[model samples]
Target chain A: MQRLFAIIGDPVKQARSPDVFNALAAERGVDAIMLSLHVGAEDFAGVLDGLSGVRNFEGAVVTIPHKRAAFLQCGSHGRAAEAAGVANVVRKTGDGLHGDLFDGFGMVNALRRAGVEPDGRSTLVVGAGGAGVAVAFALAEAGAAPIQVRDRDTDRCRQLVHQLTQSGYPACEFADDFQGLRLVVNCTPLGLDPADPLPVAPERLDPDCVVADAVMAGRATRLTAAASARGHAVVPGEEMLAGQMPAIWSFFGLPGETDISAAKR
Target chain B: MQRLFAIIGDPVKQARSPDVFNALAAERGVDAIMLSLHVGAEDFAGVLDGLSGVRNFEGAVVTIPHKRAAFLQCGSHGRAAEAAGVANVVRKTGDGLHGDLFDGFGMVNALRRAGVEPDGRSTLVVGAGGAGVAVAFALAEAGAAPIQVRDRDTDRCRQLVHQLTQSGYPACEFADDFQGLRLVVNCTPLGLDPADPLPVAPERLDPDCVVADAVMAGRATRLTAAASARGHAVVPGEEMLAGQMPAIWSFFGLPGETDISAAKR
Candidate 1:
């Protein structure tokens, strides 16, 4: 029996999931097909209604705008989805559609795969959006100590810190400045465009710290370049995308352990 | 400046659009990036809100669940999107997002590329889902003399007939069986699995008919295989996916002139 999976969104043409999963599926000899679905907000309910009736479509990977809805739609959700109020993956269990978030898992997996474990490390993270939240939660779970989160929106930073600690990381804190931080992550799109400035003051960065930017600009992002120039190792956004695939495949009940680093080769 | 294109869906990972578009973009000198977005049903408004505020992202390809919403959300829709009451592509303009559907275009392009024009020919399309509607519309627009549509639901067949004529195809009709139809299309998943029954009874198919199955089963679908055994020409679903690239690219304000069939070679 062939398993069917779909990635649904409003403008669904640019999705890489179908190829990624299908590639893995083909390698695994599983008769599975994955397709991209363009779904709009108004049609979300209807699309779900239609998908719910289809037995072959075994799973779905939820993205922006729908992550929160995915959490609510599922009969049950995992702890991370419940905490972040978002879901990056869903599966059709015997009970119903089960939703869970693998965003944090992707982040943690990326860090671990890169041999840069955040456990017990003092970390400084910039930006507090969706990816940032996932990263923060993942770092907390990874045993990172005293992780400092910064965002232009102080409230969001405060909320992330609260969530991180409430979720069981006792060392979470809000950082108004980047001092005494060893691991720095820029999760904002500040460096995606050539015109955008570094998310943080270059002079303020610790020379020995490891920096990672969640932006892909062909080459190193300004933040990554700056950090590298200052003798710090940097992780690119592609690494994060690659790191998330294994968990994603598992989320879909598909086989294949993915190493995003291998994809770079 | 890199051109921005996107595939929007609630769960966007399961999409080949990024690979297809990125490969196309790499082949060209155009600095462009294709990405997937996960948007939820209620988040449609929020997605539009986000798109309006962004600078780099330009156009998007809509997918299932969001097609009807895209049709409703667009400032204006083309004849095909309007006819089907759905859209698979949306180009952002100064006025707003303009919607069109390339599903029909893909089928039309495939037939034209294969030297089998839908115009003035008899077409028997099986299934009445989104793909069927698009194929039917394309055939109707291309001036097919008589088009026959059938679905499990008789009302759906009636609805298709009404929509086809409303779109200016006067010769549209519903048929309970494939008698003298020159073209046979299996738009349903009936032939998806190796075990699934052929959409059409093999003995009922005309040996001279052109059989096309939209279900991609890695080999000829049971319908197509049966057609081949009976000395009929066959079209695969993968061809449809490949054929839609050019028109879809053009609709996105990108160059899709390169034949997608060549990609297979």
Candidate 2:
């Protein structure tokens, strides 16, 4: 039977997950497809209830406002989801639905793929929403020190820093400035609209500093472009998204790249 | 945004709606795909409730055990659905979900397409299940008279005949035998398994009696094969399913054949 998976969020039209996941599934000859399901926050629980009844519904990728709600719904959680208090991916297990956070993993993976090690790096994480908190936790887990968190909502930013401190991550604090940070990751939505300003002043960063944006625009985000022009290495959000696919595919029990490669040989 | 549609049934792996609907949707360049959702009878209402919360879920093709349940859940019904007391297709309307029966329409449409008109023809419909009732009502609406309905369950068979007669379809009665029928349609699961006996003996029908089977076995059913070998016109279940696509597509507000043709030019 062809298994059903969905990326659930409100205003889901711009989601690239269906295209990305479907293409990978097709390439691997898996009998599955990921769909973009536009569902409001109010209807999240009800929709999950309905989807649970479908035996062929293997899993779903939760996005945006639904991530935290999905985390709450799961019977169990991965370490990353537990740390971030949110879930971006869910799989139906024998016992029940298992939720996990991949946003932080994706960000860290993207950085590693771009040849920037997070260990001992001074990191500044902008935005304290689900994605920002996830990135902060993952960076801390990857040995990034003195992680400075920033968000327009001061309370949310302080809460994230406090959570990181309580979790025993060293030197977690609110960002006072962009000074001396070796890695600056923007988890804000600033780059989504063309008219939106860059999340940080790239000029203030050291020329060797690496910049990453979580905004998944079709092209380069303003922050990434500005940082790149200044000769700093930049990671676009798409790479982070790509980094998450293998884990997501495996979570749903679909064949991964290695399996496909071996089968071909 | 890509729309989500589903064919919901118990034991749904055998269903061909996903293939057929997905192919047509692709041919028309519609951003929609139909998936097979396996939900047992007990979970039908819960699943429907969940699906209703999906903003992008335009409709569903309900099959087998869920047909009557779907009818009961619909806010309103088309004439055919009301007559059959079941729904095989449902669409989301501004008010709520509206359901309709297309099995009867599909059977009649297939017959007409195969150059065997049901108008004023004496028809014997086997199996008083959801598909059988739908086909019988459709045939009656298309001017097939003296409709003879039969099923192993005598009570269900008598109920369909009574309903048809009460709905003002003339000469509706329970079948005693295959005698002198101009059209014979098998709506039972008899042909699905090759070991099962034919719903009716082909030798008992008149030489020119048109035969149709609602069983959608991949290959020709024994009844259709036998009737065809004996020089009778035959309509397979696939043709009936094909006949329903245009109406189903239209019901979901997707572009129809004419629109595709026009686009091609």
Compared with the true structure, what per-residue lDDT tens digits does model 2 show for residues A1-265? Answer: 8889998987566777777788787877888988889899999988988898899898998876788899999999988898778898998888878999888888887888888999999999999988998899889999999899888898998899888889899755555666788999999878888899988989999988899988877688889989999999999887776667777888778866533222111
Q: What do the candidate models score in CA lDDT, each in turn? A: 0.71, 0.84
Kindly list the per-residue Cα lDDT of model 2 for residues B111-197, writing each as its tens digit: 887889899898999999889888988888899987998888989988988888888997555556666689989999788778889
Interface RMSD of 2: 0.5
Q: CA lDDT of B63 in candidate 2?
A: 78
The top-ranked prediction according to TM-score is 2
Off by over 4 Å in 1: A1-22, A33-75, A92-97, A163-177, A188-197, A215-220, A256-265, B1-265
Pick out the ten consecutive residues of candidate 2 chain B with the lowest summed lDDT: B256-265
Give interface RMSD for all predictions: 11.9, 0.5
Worst 10 residues of 1 chain A by lDDT: A256-265
